[model samples]
Target chain A: MSETMKAAIFVKPGEMTVREVPKARIEQVGDAVVRVVRACVCGSDLWYFRGLSAHPHNSQIGHEAIGVVDEVADAVTSVRPGDFVVLPFPYSCGTCPVCRAGFESVCPHGGYFGASQAEYVRVPEADGTVVKVPGSPEDYDDETLASLLTIADVMSTGYHAAVSAEVRPGDTAVVMGDGAVGLCGVLSARMLGAGRIIAMSRHEDRAALAREFGATDIVAERDQAAVDRVLSMTGGYGADAVLECVGSRQSFDTALGLIRRGGVIGRVGLPHDVEISAEGTFYGNIGIKGGPAPVRHYDLEAGLLDAVLERRIDPGRVFTGIYDLDQIQAAYEAMDRREVIKSLIRF
Target chain B: MSETMKAAIFVKPGEMTVREVPKARIEQVGDAVVRVVRACVCGSDLWYFRGLSAHPHNSQIGHEAIGVVDEVADAVTSVRPGDFVVLPFPYSCGTCPVCRAGFESVCPHGGYFGASQAEYVRVPEADGTVVKVPGSPEDYDDETLASLLTIADVMSTGYHAAVSAEVRPGDTAVVMGDGAVGLCGVLSARMLGAGRIIAMSRHEDRAALAREFGATDIVAERDQAAVDRVLSMTGGYGADAVLECVGSRQSFDTALGLIRRGGVIGRVGLPHDVEISAEGTFYGNIGIKGGPAPVRHYDLEAGLLDAVLERRIDPGRVFTGIYDLDQIQAAYEAMDRREVIKSLIRF
Candidate 1:
């Protein structure tokens, strides 16, 4: 293996470049070096690429990926070299009190994944964060790989929203956003047995995807009009639960407006310019529950991975565009231009 | 009985007055006339009295009271004339979707008590809204009356906070504020079996009441110090749930700071100038869940009134000052001056 490999680096706002970087190695007792097989651009990456987030820290851009374990630290017991693995973004020690509570995203030693469209990536707390995919990495088809990749971030995030909102069977659930996370939220609500899934999508292509993902209705309206639409659909009452996949104030407002009394808003999107006032939340008797997605190792523990592996759920349809490592920048540009819902990069 | 009675009306900002209004009579089929026996000033009422809330519509002041049934319309089946009852503030038809969902505070037909520190009140939806005390109006003494009165608003609101946060037994809880609701929260948390109930009270008298109410610890510190104290107590992990009884931004911030990952902040206080940003809430995996207390018919349904009657929780101590109805304005002044945590006016 080459000592240096090509990896995507977020140099500054609105900029990401691919260059040969030092290959990853098992640096800690519970670490593993995984050779990248599939990686994807996330909706949140737009926060940096669009100058909404601060300039890059480490610059290795992508945080969601599927790979094969190339090396493993001696103490890592969960997986072995040559095993296919899904690297969850927020890597952490599995035993922390916060992680034990199933909020591993905010674990004690929590940090981002450096899987950034790279040839190789070092995964910390491998025993807890690296979810081994069944069979070899090469054995999985492209659709399965893409579906599993969603679990690493957006799919699990959407699932977290559904779970956080406590979407029981036969619930009227509204997913606010047209992005991958929102589409995945529609899929998740269906998987969670939601009776009616309303996708708040204004775009044609995204709306089509939302419907395909099992959205019963498409609310193309915005603001209070959108609220009225959902209320109208649900017999002048709003949804029993809302999945806020868009973290902006408007999306939050839509989520708040979408829920009936006693409903919960499963907030997954990274919040920006949004303030949940007590006046807005309390009077409606609405509950705000959810934060970042607790992907929880993005493994069998979440059940979605197993669903993807089995025939239970097929979330692969969310990947509207696909590319190779060499086309990393173009893939991001395509996402930035709204030319792709999400692009999967094959290594 | 006289055809007219004296009642308090909010005349203007910073001013309230007593007026000889027509004694209430059952107007709605589901209505009952209640002669006010014991009425108390609420912390939220202070918002109107202190000119923080807009000038009132009905001008009827007090919303928390224990009263006597003077008359009942044909359809009212819950109580008859001379029966003692607690008039929970937000009188609503219990069968409305919002009410049936247990959020009567915002019920469709919901309106203020019309209790207004008055001698008589007309309670609409009496069958669904009023709770008959275990005995006649003459049965309970001053202490029990005061304690039961707390349940109509503050105590139930406080309990709602604990419930909204899903405060299970053996969990650590924090109560913010030294007002009646905050003190009630401390007591309610105790009743809920919270292992450690921390009362954030800087006032010596209120803190004493909090401690008497079963607060395991009292953190008189403000801001970060208070948060640090709770964190230090809980091994730097913060409480499992927080009861926010102070609606200011600082109190909301304190409540957010006091909860660990997966903890809920049951926000019961009437919010003022407080906006809980998603940025502040989501990262901690924290949830925001309270609103105005539903009061749940103010009794056996709420479980707290029964708790009070059973002598398991004594919230009467929250009534630091007492007066007769003739001294209503003076009572309001004293409460406004912060000379009393809460004051009860006997008719």
Candidate 2:
């Protein structure tokens, strides 16, 4: 292993630069070193780059990744050298009472990896955070791995929204965004037995993909009109469940208005200083279940990898543009211009 | 039956006058005529009497009662003549799907009884709305029956709040408001298996009853300090469930703030405007389950009668003042002055 490895670092707000940094090494007995195969930019990742987040400057810039286990410490037993693995973005010890209760995302001892986007990453609690991919071809390609990368973060977030919404068979679920997480919510709702999945998207392209991913309907309206469309489609009873995938106030209002009485609203959107009306929610008997996308709770690294291996869900479609590690700024520019659904960086 | 019966009539706001009206006769096939043994005034009834409600003038006031079945219609089979029964305030047919689902308070064919405080009340859907008292004693008295009268309204509202809050065994529940409903909430929480019950009351006398009824703690504070007091008692975790028994905005905020994360807030308070902020409710993942009291859902008439018969709860403590059929105005004035928890009008 080289003493210094290539990493993409956020030098300042709205800037990314490639640099050779000391490769991540096992700092704890439960840690492991993984060689990155593919990593992608997430919508939240953009928040830091756009100066909207409180993240420190010159920090590691990516979180979603699929990699090969290069080395494991004495305490690590889940994966070995040369094994393909998917890493949960927010690493968890996965042995706490909360994790035992299947809420590992909020595990007390969890920490995130890839603070500086490097080729080799150090994963804490490797036995619990990394899931070895099974039955992979000898020469697996980057796109397949990049698509699988999403399960570590955004895809898992979408799945969490679906689960929290209590999407059941013959129930209508409305997704309130068209981003990567929203698209995954469309797929997750279908997988969870939602009879009719409505994806609210203004873009024709995203709406088309949502349809292909099992969205039964697409409501192109926003705000009050969007609520009216959902109500009309459900015979005035309103959707049985609603998924708020966007953190904006408009999306929150739309999700609340689209659900019926006694309905559940699963909100996974991360917002800055968001407030919900107490009286409005109380009178409607609306139940809300969500926070910070409990990525570890869903065991995304393992469950999502199996889905990829079975070809049950194709998340790689989220990555529309790819760039070598040196073209990181160009990748961000394309994503900012909305020219790509997601941009990937290759080693 | 007499040709004319003594009845209490609210001819104008803040005044009640007794008038001779024709005795109520069984009009519907399923109806029964109940000779009122005891009746009580409710806070909501005062709203109408004070002209603060949307109800029209000359509307029959007073919905709580315990009475004897004097006559049964042709189709009536649940109760027979001489049977002492407790009437559910909102008369439900009890055969609709909603009623079948145990939401009888919102029964499609249900409506309130006693257009005027009459001596004989014609109860519609008698088979569904009336519960025959078990083991009638030879010496049946008004005090025992008067306490049982609350089962029809305030007591039921309190029970509904606890049920909607999903108060479970070993959980802490906070009841907001020191009104009759709030005091009843303390009893309901005990019945529902709440390990720790916190009653928020400004009145020391009501707080004492709350404790006697099984409240483990008393929060005399009203505003944000009350919320802090509840949190302080719960080790900063907040109550596992909260009952919003008061309809004011302050009570609403107190209830919302008193509940822990993932806690349920049951709101039975009927607000005039029904307005609440969305931001405060959305982020916490709190669930709310209630609007108007579902008096019919829990078979309050039967349940409360059973409780009374078994000597489990005594609502008579709430009735601190009593008046004749003609002293209704003074009764209202006394209640307004907070000199009485509840005032009963004897016909």
Candidate 3:
């Protein structure tokens, strides 16, 4: 193993530099050293780089990945050398009250890895956070594994939105975004047995993917017109459930407007601020369920690893752009310019 | 029967005049003439008298009452002459789609009676809107029936708020406001098996009755302090459910602050124009459920009639003041001065 690993480091906001840094080592008792097989960029990561977030400068960058367990501490019993696993974005001890209640993402003592976007990562609580991939071909393939990376964050987030929305069988759901998370919401709604899935998007390319993911209808319009279209499609009763994948006020209003008198609205977008009218929500009998997506609760990394090995849901299609670790700045720029759905960093 | 009956008419806002008006005759196919034994003023009726509502001048003055069927139209088959019945505040046709879905109060064709505050009231959709009191004595009684009149409006409204709040057995509920609706909320919470009921009140008299009606705790304070007290009583987790019975901004904010995470906040008060913060509701996972109370949906009038006959719930305690038919202005004055929880007019 090399003493140094290449990493895409953010020296400051809007600045990314490829540097050879000392490889991550097992720092805690339950830590496991994994050789990163693949890592991807997320919309939230861009927030930090674009100076929109309060994240400290030079902080570790990415939070999504799939890797092999190259080393484990004495206290770690879940994985060993040569085992393939996916890391949950939020590293949870998996033994807190919130975790026991199935809300792991909000674990009181959880944090994330990939602070430096490196070739290798040290995962804390390895036994509790990493899920092993079964029946893997010995060779690590980027395409197959890239999809698994989504399970670590965005995919699980979409699942959270569906769960919060309480999407039941025979329900109609409207997803209000065309981002990766929104696309995953379309898939989640289908998996949850929503009879009708409406994806609200103006992007033709993304809308096509949403349809492939089982969207029964695509609302190309935005705002009030989009809400009207959704109501028109649902026999004037509005959708039974709405997923506010975009946290903007406009998206929230659309979700609220498209839901029926007794429907649920689940939100997962990290907006700067969102406000709802009491009169409107109360008069319409609308209920809202959302907060931070409890990614740890769904244990997506573990579940997706098994699902991926068994050829269930494909998440790799979300990755529309890829770049070498040194080209991290260009990746962020492309994503910001809406040139790609998502960008990935290759070691 | 006499060709005319004593009635109270609102000549203008804040003034009422009593005169001999022709006894109501059966005009609609389903209309039934009821000889009113008792009728009471409602808080909502005050809005019309104060010119805050769009009610026409000289319209009927009351909507809550217990009466006997004096005459029945050919189409009315549910009740016969001399049958003791309770009239639901809002008359529902009971066959509309909204009514069939258990939202009778919001029925498109539903309307209220007692436009003249008359001794003989005409009820529409008699077969569907009036419920006869079972096992009642042959002689008509006013006091006992007056207590049951609460179910026609305020009691039903309170029950709706509690139901919307999802008040379940062993849950703690906080009721905002000390009005008749708030008192009814205390009883409704008890009926719903709430583990603890906290009634917010500033009036000592109302607070006393609140306890009698089953409020386990009383927070006489208002605003933030009241919210803190409610939270303190619930071990800092906030109540499991909260009923916003007041329409003011302060009441709404207090209700919002008293509910726990993932808790329900049911609001039944009609607000003029209040801006509810969507971000505040979304980030906490709070669920809001409520609109206008479906008083006609749950057979409230029937239930109350039976309760009155059985001496189960006493609604008459709400009436603290009474006046002759011609003294309607005094009744309103007393209510405005907070000298009475409710007022009644006698001919």
* TM-score, cand. 1: 0.90
- Evaluated at residue B109, the lDDT of candidate 1 is 73
Each candidate structure's TM-score, on Cα atoms with residue i matched to residue i, is: 0.90, 0.73, 0.76
- Order candidates by DockQ, high to low: 1, 3, 2
Over the stretch B1-347, how does candidate 2's per-residue lDDT look in tens digits? 66888777777777776777788888889999988877878887777677787665554567787778889999998889999887777787887534554556655577767553568898999988886776452455655666677777788888888987879888889998778988988899999899999998879889888999899988888778998888788767578889888877778777777777556688787765545444445445466666555565554433766776666788777888888877877887788778898988776
lDDT of 1 by residue, A17-112 (tens): 788888887778888899989899998888888888786554677789888999989998889989998888788787766776678887757777
Give one digit per residue, the lDDT tens place, for model 2 in A159-265. Answer: 88887787888778899888889999898899889989999998877888899989989899898999898889976657778888888877887787888755678
Docking class of 1: medium
Give per-residue CA lDDT, model 1, range B1-347, as digits (tens): 55888888777766677888888787879988888888988877777778777755446777888888889999987789888888888888888656766778877677766455888888889987887787786777778888888888888888888888778788888988889888888888887789888888778898888998889888889999888888889888788889888888899888877788878888888788887777768887898887878896435566777788888888888888998877777788888988999999888
Which DockQ-derived CAPRI band holds candidate 2?
A: acceptable
In candidate 1, the residue pairs with backbone N, CA or C atoms under 3 Å apart (3 or more residues apart, or in different chains) clash, namely: A10-A59
Better of 1 and 2 by TM-score: 1
lDDT (C-alpha) at residue A173 in model 3 = 90
Off by over 4 Å in 3: A1-39, A44-59, A62-153, A163-169, A191-193, A271-275, A298-327, A330-334, A337-340, A343-347, B1-39, B46-59, B62-148, B191-193, B297-335, B343-347
For residues B196-243, what per-residue lDDT tens digits would candidate 3 score against the true structure?
Answer: 999998898889999999999889888899888877886666888898
Question: What would the per-residue lDDT of candidate 3 be over residues A159-191, giving only the tens digit for each residue?
Answer: 878877879897889998888999989988998
Best by lDDT: 1
Model 3 gets an lDDT of 0.77
State iRMS for model 3. 3.4
